[model samples]
Target: MIDNEPHKTKAYIAGVNLNDPNFDYYMTELANLTEANNMEVVGQSRQNTEQIVAGTYFGLGKINEIKSMAHGLKAKVLVLNDELSPVQIRNLEKLTKLRVIDRTELILEIFANRAKTKQAKLQVQLARLQYELPRLHPSENSLDQQRGNGGSTGGGFANRGAGESKLEMNRRTIDKQISAIKKELKKVANQEDIKSKRRNKKQIPKVALVGYTNAGKSTTMNGLLKEFTDESSDKEVFVKNMLFATLDTSVRRIDLNKNFSFILSDTVGFISKLPHNLVESFKATLQEAKDADLLINVVDASDPNMIQMIRTTQSVLREIGIKNIPMITAYNKADKTDRNYPQIEGNDILYSATDEKSIKLLAKLITKRVFANYKKFNLLLPLSDGKTLAYLHEHAQVMKESYENDGVHAEVRLAPENQERFKKYLV
Candidate 1:
């Protein structure tokens, strides 16, 4: 889909830190996330508290101060860098007199606005409902109690049929909507399952890209694909540098050349202290990560909290039961940083995908790492068999090839599945 840049809105952002070291990075990323969603940061406020205040997010005094500052600046919106409770949200709204949003709510609103596809829409709705389900207002919870008025048997809507109370009716409506979204998501999953099965049948390797929010996962995905595909064609390749840029999993068949096309999947990125409801809702979408044969864990080389981000990503990966998968850490954005080295231990590669040489290095490393798990084979094909020769050149690494009187003698290294295809051509 074509993307027209959005008009930016001026807003104020605040972070309440209980003396945490990562507070600065969190607030910084929060600002960027807001900007990505077309909000301009007019000002920022940070409050240090010995303990988190229960009533207001940043203690009563700091809340008043922020309110005064926002009022003076005429900020259109007030964004909290931390997660705010429902009561706190309501209280803050009353005090600040501006639209107050917590980080989770802000992220959900961004996802809701950015979702374009049917699967993406369903995913966002499921996530939003899940987030809302537990945060229902006290009055809303009372609606769940369907005890009829005046203790009469016909308490609710009083009808000949079994009518529900106002509260029960609301709950039923929400439940029905949730159920419908899940049902639609299941259909999309089934379709994806069929595609997954077909790839397995062909013995294609599945590689998934996972990282923290705004670590450039989607940008890297675009660079990887664009490296191989002719992007100048009428078909425009979608690449957004924004956080959660690619909400829905986009699986593309990448030609590793020499008869091998491995599947590359761009999955949702993980975040520090990600809300549980969002995680639970996105489980199906993240199943693509768990099922991956290899994981390309992307990291922002310029981020100060790179270590924390790494741990957060690992925490989620463990939660998903992906313990023993081989991973290649791709430290991205080397171009913008003073230095691009990460001290993390792993089979890793560091490069800005924007650089042509970096793209080549990444592609080469990908091919090398993926083929390491496969067996090698040698075969002889006739020179007249142009089709098989061309196939070999496209999908396999031809270590040795020679023109012969009878045919062509070729020794190749490839995945085992290609072994059978070359069997008939073997001398």
Candidate 2:
């Protein structure tokens, strides 16, 4: 049967394996990324070589082979698994007669398209500018022509040749834009820091949802929101069956109970081989996870590549400098498999986000883990000291409070720090 779908850019993907065991998984992720970017992958190939060619990414014979195969499949673009230099990209474009896109460029394009908010847009722009700063050609016509033989040596704005002039002008423009964006981002980050300080003053136990993209982190967050938060149902973070459906960080207060109340944040998901520029640009957006008291690494239980996905998340977490923090491996989408609805195995849980009971169990597990060290304390504050009374509610879980002639008595559960700070009020 002749099948037909809407017009999409047909792309051919290829990679060179340098004897790495994870090469195949990288290619699989590349294909998924291509599809996520609204491109149809028509063919794929790999060359087993110990070293990469400096000029052209692939050997002469392999390039010709891939060119013929891509042409036969009517592919209009060639995608590679690794980032390519300007020289390699230009050389391959000349040899294959097809537009060439490296992994970094492809990921950046997707991020640029998905960005919606001002901060996310600025971050993607910053990363794109940094990526393009080094890859700019002297002119549209020629990839070479002595683009100033590297950086400035002694030339001033008064004198420059025509080609050098244009190249230098473009570089300066991008540099200025990069500096401006960084300034704006710093302002945004300062605002975020102020808000973070307020949350810290309250001493709420903060939990962050983090995992691989399209692994249902948002869905899990929505489940918790629907069950706990007072916000309208529509206030949930964006959810779609696609990679990077949401790029912004969302923090909401989850009051599961008076004792279990805490702050929950949903952050951008991770992917294997994520670009370093993108990571550096998004560090501020990912600040929630860094400050989290606990992390939930949601995994797709039904995916055949489950193990690889878990490993990828771990690798990305380490790359981002998150360590020594408590984490739970939540195996989501268990309903897709023939397993039970919800079950906990030590720090890991097999559950489905759509199931109400599963959400409750997961919440209970989190509550247990977050508050295990909390201890009950009895305190008596003078009736005139309303300030400490109010602080008690925010800093600790106040279980009971009563006013008498001389003072106010209260029962509360406090963390170690809170307990030490309030020891003077113990009765």
Candidate 3:
């Protein structure tokens, strides 16, 4: 921690591999992350090396240059946009005389602040421990003192009645902590299983909002919910603007119309270059997307890389084992687009989410998509049998209704599974 209350400090990027096209984007996101954490970027340095030094990540010349720059700017923090090995971290700290952190640590810190639910906090702690385990290499400064005194080959304590490496003990401790965290998560997963079973029994059609981070997903959700419910009573609908905003799943019951309605679920956002381990840990949270009946893959219309973001979103979806779900692309932020947006493959629907016409079109498109799979039915019920008519109207979308001499005649479209409920009136 800085002695002076963490003033926004200048920093720069180092150890960049230029062969990868995504390197620039990753560095840009790193800048964004730093800004999010209340830091300022004074400069950035890039290198074309494939293998970083085992000690200092940058070459000795580059390290000396960095040292001078840090002293010149009085930079308190050196943010490396890549995961540095423990030795590299130690070397950088000694050379720069500043707190050195990698992308993993930076992300975990952001997660630490954003985590709201019990499960999210646990997962963040797990990731943090895993990251800190390696970097927490016991003070070699003390180890050097022990070595100077000729206590053992290495500076620190030993194991099994013999001098063992300090690194070995640290590794063992990390392994133990990882196992314990996994056990705790297993218990949480069991509770999730029970909750999922209950939701299945209710058989409510689920629509999940999924997209890349900072892609206005939460904004879209707030707009959609605000359109459906009055502002005073829509307190349950939560909206936030941050990386991984909406970490915990928020389920809202939306009334599509008088006859058909379903639940809309907003979930955690995805990011480019998201660590595989983090993705694995967030599987349970992402199960909401997997179980959704339909996915509104929200895209930022103004972003130039909408196609790449869409691909990344789909890749994450497939990683979580969700395929074959009907999807509608919700091209959000259309009002901000310079010109009218072009269409994408697979049932694309364009809307600003802030526009009244756009939101109505979205609702209509959702209804049409859901009803496309429904089986058409024409039934005539006796006038005396009010129970059956009410049941039909409640369970299925009754497109047309006519009063008949016998009772009422209704033409409706309903899912094949729901058709069984009205078998008695079929004629």
Candidate 4:
């Protein structure tokens, strides 16, 4: 028998730091991203500089040193900490004799590998193509043929002389693919919009969970779903202890009690220096957060770089055009820290998502923030007006109900909009 397991590439990570306070944290993230892409991080290097080198990312001497070190470590790939210019990537690869991959490309590769759904696959593909469009070179005119043949050359001298025309053809093909993907994405988004409108008609508030990748957003979602939702495997989203574990958005109606119900969504997690193209492509998936009434910004309280991670999430949210929405800073993973679990600070909470009591407290906090405008109302509907009564049952929190000779009497908690709509039947 022959063994046929694919070999993992050995990657050496490096970055040029311009005295950034978060330089080490960023390099750590680069290494993690490398591992997430199924590459083994065999070595690392960093250089402090006043500014990045324009032609080559690192100083010539630094590059030479990195080349020697990587050679010694048997590294086959050089992963940089920041997005590099096309010229820089080419120069570095020529000087070091190793494949050069920038931060943006690495992140995109991880996303491409992790995408499971058609929407996610299309989104990642769009971002990857956009990243490559600007980096195309005249010498790489065979790119279209290579991609068309599934990422491999046909092992012949065919089309060895074609130049400008081939590049133009490749560009046009990519442009056409981009347009087709956008059209398909629009169709999927329209379907989602219809469902969202249905949820909107129910008059329930929406809350979205967002945070740094692997900072426990999916775990938190599972915890809430397990405790509040009827036990069903399909109701739970996938939970894993890895970066970018959840790529698709998952929405579930969480009924906290007979008197409380709101829509909860778990969105794709954010990361520092996320590629702009990726964000643009994911806009449809992230619309849930954009339309949310409240956002729970989950943080890993146990991580030493928690503050930086929080800032990264906030920056990404702003880039995604989410502004002025109410948010609660949920410092999760309290069990990993020494602080008491389920502790509440103003506009923030320190809690473990896996704890039942902590989940209950989180639910209460969400209800308080999302339902702040709801008010109690006493109403009487005519016995024949069964439609209105049924509407109330579906949309409002019915505190009390009874049948009377004159009509059906009930006390309910209604949102501000609902309160006005049912004013005619008020007691």
Candidate 5:
């Protein structure tokens, strides 16, 4: 078979740890991010310091050491854990003789590559422009040679292929682009808002799946789709074993039974140290979760770093201002471990999404939570009120119905407001 894979750029990862305890985990995330961006991490280096150097991130001695180590590894790119100023980036490149990329840029590049929808693409573009807005310098700097590099490493803040032209874009041009993207995104967000309002009008309890990247959110979504809905492949969202696999939020109505149903939405996964601009740009895309009556925070139960991953999800949730929402800690991928499958402990569960039994149990749990507020009612409407009969069948969960000569008898589950509206017809 012909080898069809393209060449992967060799990258050396490094970070300046300013006495933080989670530094090592952050570095591991950096390496994973590098690979996710289609690069190979050849090696890594870190500096534990009390204070960062003003000009460069790492001290001069450590910088020289990293440069030597990276050169020995035959790495073409030097990836850093923190976002650096333009001067520091230029200085690092000149000293290390490799293209420099920061953590923020790496994430943006991944998002830029993964964004497929119009709204998602525009959001990523908006974030990229905002990130570059400040980094762009009016005058020429030391990256003149980067212009000749031909973007072989793919387009990014650091790997900017055909580099100088993008760097040469003045602030005014970038500002205009930012404004245009914002205007377009606003229109799209308004459309999304309209759709959300319609869903709200249905009064279906909305449920959202949220978690760290590559944590099986899409797989769980597929499990629910296949179990509750038709097994048509077109209804399933994309599933992949990589970071940020599902960028666009997917909304589908999950009907557990005639009397119970909720709108389920699978959302974009979160990552550690996600760029602030990216979060702000994605707020509209994440509105489903914000409006959700319940959230399923999926976790990779088999991964060693599950705790940190959960923390990362919580952090991003907090950043997006989502608080007091009911959340279920869904520890997925139990088949990969030695533990028993489909066990619920308080508000959390240990289950595998691919198992039919597990999906049934999860659905049961969701129904219990989402329908907890519903009130059952018995009402008699006049035979002339066919519109009300149709409305009750469509909106309320009708458990019993009958036709009488003088009126229609119905026993249904209704929300609090619905309970009050039809009180006149109470039987």
Candidate 6:
């Protein structure tokens, strides 16, 4: 019988430590990223150095040691913990005889693989092209060949007529593609902007869920939607126990009751040292968070690296220009820990997203924080003022309402803006 198991690329992950305290955690994350990209991490190496070698990332001796050890381990790819310069990548590949993939490229490849929506696809493609443009070299036209059309012919052909090498033509083509993708992206963004403007006009409070990848954000969203919204498969976002499972922003209206409703958005999760290009390209998708009135920073309480993960989320939020937004730290996965479930400490909640009681408590905490400024009002509207009564029902949290000879009498919680609108009806 012939053995026909599928082959997985054997990858050796390595990193140079400049005495950073988080070096080990970074290496662990690199290994996870490699696995997420469908490669098997076969072995690992690390070097402690005062400074990185400008031309080769690792010193010559370290590189030689890595080369020998990787060969012994049957590893065909060298995965680095940090992004490398193009020169460093080429030099390492030459020295080690293994294909070199740096941290940034590895992350971009994952995003490319995970992108499902057109906007996400275009964003990843734009970022990839931007990353590749400067890395393009004359000798690497073989890359184009590998993709297809190996010979110097077709559009990339050196127009023996123009003396442009296929390399230059390839660069030109990428530039054109980048421009075209940007134009299309802008059009899509404009459409999103229109919808966003409409949502803004409603003046509903917006809350965004942001956290580290695989931290159970999508699960939390599903829980909220299930409990607070009409339960439907379409209302649920994708949930999986994997990195980067969600690439697009999902926005839903969360109706807590007849009295309280707010817009909720779940955004792409953050990772440590995410590729700069990826972050830049996904800014549009993160707009929901940037525009939010409050943010629920969900965290994996069971993870040992919880503190670092929290910092990573904060760093990414700042990079995206989100500032001074009120945030509640939601420590999820409390079931995996000995701590109490659905416990609130100040503005933070420790809970499991899957537990119904925990979800309810989380919702209560969110409602309390997001609606803290709302004021209670008692109003009486005349029978002819049915429109005013309807407005109160739609905009304010109507706590109590009854039909009377005067018209309609109600007690409601009114947001600051609506407080002014209903002042004339106050009793």
Runs of candidate 6 with Cα error greater than 4 angstroms are 1-5, 142-166, 378-412
lDDT per residue for candidate 2 within 1-427, as digits (tens), equals: 6668778999999999999998988999999999989999999999999999999989999999999999999999999999999999989999999999999999999999999989999999999999999987655422233343443334554434655767787788889999999999999999999999899878889999999999999999999999887774866888999999989899988989776788889988888889999999999999999999999999999998889999989988898899989999999999999998799999989999989999999999999999999999888888888788888877888788888886988888998877888899899
Q: How far is 243's C-alpha from truth in model 5 (Å)?
A: 0.1
Compose the digit string of candidate 6's lDDT tens values, residues 132-177: 9888766555466787755544444444433346568889989999
Candidate 4 clash figure, as a count: 0
In candidate 5, list every pair of residues with a backbone clash.
151-161
lDDT of 3 by residue, 68-145 (tens): 887787777888878778888878898888888888777777778888888888787787776666555444423335
**The best candidate in terms of TM-score:** 2
Residue 322 of model 1: what lDDT? 83
> What Cα-based lDDT does every candidate model obtain?
0.76, 0.90, 0.74, 0.90, 0.89, 0.90
TM-score of each: 0.77, 0.92, 0.79, 0.91, 0.90, 0.89
Model 5 agreement with the true structure over 73-157: per-residue lDDT tens digits: 8999999999889889989999888999999999999999999999999999999989987786523422433555332434465
Candidate 1 wrong stretches, greater than 4 Å: 1-9, 138-165, 229-236, 338-346, 378-427
- Relative to the true structure, candidate 6 reaches a TM of 0.89
Worst 10 residues of 6 by lDDT: 154-163
Estimate candidate 3's alpha-carbon lDDT, on a 0 to 1 scale: 0.74
1-427: candidate 1 lDDT, tens digit per residue: 8778665676889988888988887887788778877788888899887877788877777878888888788787899887878888878888888888889888888888978888888888888887776565424343445543322334344441333344456666678889999999899889888987766655567888888877877777777677776652332235666777677787787775655557788877777666666677677778777888789999888877888888878998887678798899899888878864322334788888677778778877777778775656668787777887787876666767888787788777766767778777665
> In model 3, what is the error at residue 79, expressed in angstroms?
1.6
- Lowest summed lDDT across 10 adjacent residues in model 5 is found at 137-146
Give the candidate order by descending TM-score.
2, 4, 5, 6, 3, 1
lDDT (Cα, 0-100) at 40 in candidate 5: 97
Give the true-structure RMSD of model 2.
4.4
Model 3 alpha-carbon drift over 4 Å, by segment = 1-6, 134-180, 230-236, 340-346, 376-413, 417-425
Q: After superposition, how far is residue 242 of candidate 4 from its true place, in Å?
A: 0.7
